[model samples]
Target: MRKILLALLVSTIGFSQNKPFAKGADVGWLPQMEATGYKFYDTDGKEKDCLQLLKDRGMNSIRLRVWVNPNNDKASGHCSKEETIIMALRAQKMGFRIMIDFHYSDSWADPAKQFKPKAWSNHSFPELLNDVYNHTFDVINALKVAGVTPEWVQIGNEIPGGMLWPDGSTNHWDQLGQLLNKGYDAVKAVDKNIKVIVHVDEGNNNAKFRTFFDNATRQKVRYDVIGLSYYPFWIKKDYTEVIADLEFNLNDMVKRYGKEVMIVEIGGEDDKVENTYQLLATAIKAVKNVPNNKGLGVFYWEPQGARSWSHYNLSAWQADGKPSPALDAFKE
Candidate 1:
């Protein structure tokens, strides 16, 4: 009876994972832009809700990032728990699946910087672990109360070097693994159906992915998905090379880890709109080509705002407030 019950539980957990081809976008800045009176328009120059425009373009999921005590840095306060919930509620109502990215910091949490939240700076290792658990649980609980259940949750963002600064850096894989497990456990505690993703940048770099996942596996870190950030321009690799490398990595990751993979974030230059379209289309194709349907999908990062609001030159929007043809790649 015990063996049967254990197998049933394991099967139930695996069955809860998302099976859809997650054509998504990381629109963490959307709510902040809307609050400042910015409106999105379609190619026809007709004003429309940003989420609706993406939905019309075939995007099925929205990824939002949440900061812990963003008030510690006023400029970085836009993605606070409350603001994320507001944006998430909008996406949920529009029938778009949601993915919550926890930055574990007051500001940006990327390869270059993953500063500890000011409130957690002085915490010991155990205290920091508890803080991570409590923050994740609180935010997820609040979102649930708001009637929004995120389909996927990223424990951290672009964490190629690991997160939470020196203590949880890649050199300290045990600590990093522990912190990540705290987050994974928190999400499962809230809802077992919500998949947890461990994200890293450089989707085409198989070496990096292997190293990170190897350490994670050694430490028994639990995760449901392998999320990657792919930017061809940053790597200075042309479209063909980028897609080939991405496909190779995606296949290897699935086979090695037995986990689903996704291009959690991707972008290209607006000046080269056609190239950007080709880039996105090629990436989606590469992901879909992963055998056994282990390739989940791709997500474009911050495609809505262009100039002043985001200053992202690679934005998938034209100057006239219309979505650039580059976004048409999602139609695939």
Candidate 2:
């Protein structure tokens, strides 16, 4: 019995060491797409569930973003806490590891804009901190109750400038750090094993990452993963040049911070399937090449979006409802 127990323990440790590489897609718009009568089809033209199709193409994880009180915007109601739970449960049932991205805003929260939610606009700094903590805790707790424990959780989405607007902007690192720490504490209080991420856009810009993380470090902001968004067309550089810069930056970040990293959001022109494929392949390879296997994986943002969502020109699906060849990059 002693020998058997020793063998079991060793096997368990070995299994834990071999963590699944997160080949994933941010299908946050999936619920909305389905509601709009969008149906995904396999290459064979047979109707299939979107998640299954992605799984068939080697995707092992799903990323969903949650908005706080999204009802303020008529077009942004699908990402509320309740809707996110429904979507997360579905992904879990399909055997996909989940990552929850908290926008902490009623609408989009990116470098260009980090507007405070309408309800929290007038909140005092301390009150706003509490709001952030409580909202994160509540959503995570609800997900736990639904039997969908996320493997990763982002405190805010693409928050290179900072979250919650002027109060938490880069200029006010103290407040930003406090808000981030509160969210981090809430996540750990719920599940210490879940890896927390601090995401930023501009994967190819090493200077930007260094600047953001330098301040974060100075302020002692706690986090586990460094998430980045890489878009080739947006960068507007030669493809090779972009890939080289991104790889260099990825390596630099891993070595500098001693933390795992992932391309949390990536997209390219939907019409340029071949170029997009090459871009993804290069980026994934760079990430996987990080020393000590500290690289987590790459996640395509809204790959399923197509003509239905005219705004997302970077979608990886063709007009015929078939996934574009660009998705083949995930197979690599």
Candidate 3:
């Protein structure tokens, strides 16, 4: 019995030492895509569940985005709080680890625009702080009630300049820091084990990360992970050109901040399957190479969102309702 117990302990330790690197997709558009009759088929041309298709392609995690109150438009809206909960529950049921991305807006929120949700537009700075805390807590608490606890929660999405418009922008680091702390606190209030992430775009731009995180450090922001977005298609540069920079930034972020790093959002052009495949393979290798195992994961943004439905060129899904070969990189 003692030898058996010792062997079991050794196996458990080995499992922990080889924690599976997160290979995931942000399928926020999935619910809407299905509602609008967007079907997903595997390479064999059989209709299949989108999440299962992703899993078959070596994905083990799903990321969902939450908007405060969004319209029901098929393309650009309808990630409302309720929809998010439903989606998270579905993904959780499939054994996929979850990551919740809070956009904190009525519609889209990114580096270019982090508009205050229309409902909170008139709020004072203090009220805005309350809004952030209450909204984050409410959604996260609801997820908890529904028996789906996320493994990670992002306070904001791709917030390079910052979020919540003029108030939470980098121009007002103090206020931004306070707002971020509120979000961090809210997530902890619900589940202290849930890792909180602060996300920004341009993962390859070391200077951007340095400047943003330097300010975050000075302002004493609270977070457990650094999330980034890397899309060579948008920058109109080949992945070959930016991949080295991304690797450098990934390592530098861990060494500089002493925090885990994740490529929270990354996508290549759908039409360029071979190139995208190589890009993904190289990117995954770079992330796994981060020393001390601080590279937590990589998530492709909207990979299942076929261009025919979402009209997004960077998806990993082909127009024929099948996954592009590019996704096979995750298998490695």
Candidate 4:
């Protein structure tokens, strides 16, 4: 009886109902005039044009990054809070769902640098928690005021090292959990339906993903998502490793943790991004083949952001509007 019970429990834990691979785009590097070589906010604010183009190309959702106070237009800090709402508003009007990514500060928020927004630059850990609440509320509120509610909101980008730094660092997931929950609660408070994502850098670490989520849940922090970043460089050339790691993480999250997984961010070098994309798409199919649809979806990172600051500012797109082999990696 114990053997039968264990088998049933394990099977129940390992399989889940089919989940759709929600098609998406993180327009973090959405083309500004400068980002597109056009020179001004002309192309920058032409969100309608941008979204229309993306939708025309098969994109159904758009994610925009919010920087608290970026130094220049070339940076995402270029995205003003107002601009984000406006973009969100426009994206919805045009039929595309939207996601707002809070970098927490004015510059780019990633695994490397999740500096606190300048406004919170002087606050202590406790005070900083309040700031996270207020900041998250303020942004979500603004979008509401604009008559544009986002479908999802990521509290911070690539928060593996922790966010708002000095205080919310990984060394203290306790503090980090409390702080992140503040943002999570702020989001839920506004639109209880809005999905919340706690992102980390690599998607291949099956064990790491489990530890992170298990830790968060144990702390009583309820989040709606598990977002991951998967760059080939970070995983190395062994496509088999990438496939194996992704499958393990996706299944483990759903079957073991009951958490839906999303490849919130992913890309390879310009030259290999195409090949990387194909392999990734194939991997998705492989996951779906597992008794049940545990694999959720993936979002290509900044494919349209162009090659401006590329490791050398080279072009990242193909001659055609479609994704290069790399971006094509997710092709259905």
How well is each residue in 177-238 modelled by candidate 1, as lDDT tens digits? 99999999999999999989999999999999999999999999999999999998887887
Mind sharing the TM-score for model 4?
A: 0.82
- Tell me the whole-model lDDT of each prediction, alpha carbons only: 0.89, 0.90, 0.93, 0.70
Displacement of residue 328 (Cα, Å) in model 2 is 1.1
Report the number of the highest-TM-score candidate.
3
Can you write out model 3's per-residue Cα lDDT over 1-332, one digit (the tens) per residue? 99999999998998787667899999999998898888999999999999999999899999999999888788779888899899999999998999999999988899889999999998999999999999999999999999999999999988988899899999999999999999999999999999999998999999999999999999999999999999988888999999999999999999999999999999999998999999899989999999978998999999998888878999999878999999999985
Q: How many pairs collide in each candidate, listed in order?
A: 0, 0, 0, 9
lDDT of each residue in 244-283, candidate 2, tens digit only: 8899999999889888999999988888888889988888
Pairs that collide, model 1:
none
Instruction: Give the alpha carbon lDDT tens digit for every residue of 1-332 in model 4.
Output: 99999999888776543334566677655545334553211123333354555555456777888877666656444777877776787778888778888888878778778777777799888898888888899999889878988877898888867788878887888898998899999999899988898888777787777777777777777788778777656656555557777767766777776666677776655666556656657655644654444455666666665554433222235333333445444445
Per-candidate alpha-carbon RMSD to the true structure:
4.4, 2.5, 2.3, 6.7
Model 1 residue 59 distance off true place after TM-score fit, in angstroms: 0.6
Model 3, TM vs. native: 0.96
Clashing pairs in 4: 13-255, 68-105, 68-106, 69-106, 273-326, 274-325, 274-326, 277-329, 278-329
Error of 4 at 23 (Å): 1.2
C-alpha RMSD (angstroms) for model 4: 6.7
Inter-residue clash pairs, candidate 2: none
Residues forming the 10-long window of minimal summed lDDT in candidate 2: 69-78
Better of 2 and 4 by TM-score: 2
Once superposed on the true structure, which residue ranges of model 4 sit more than 4 Å away at CA?
A: 1-20, 34-50, 286-294, 308-316, 319-332
Candidate 2 wrong stretches, greater than 4 Å: 1-15, 72-75
Which candidate gets the maximum lDDT versus the true structure?
3
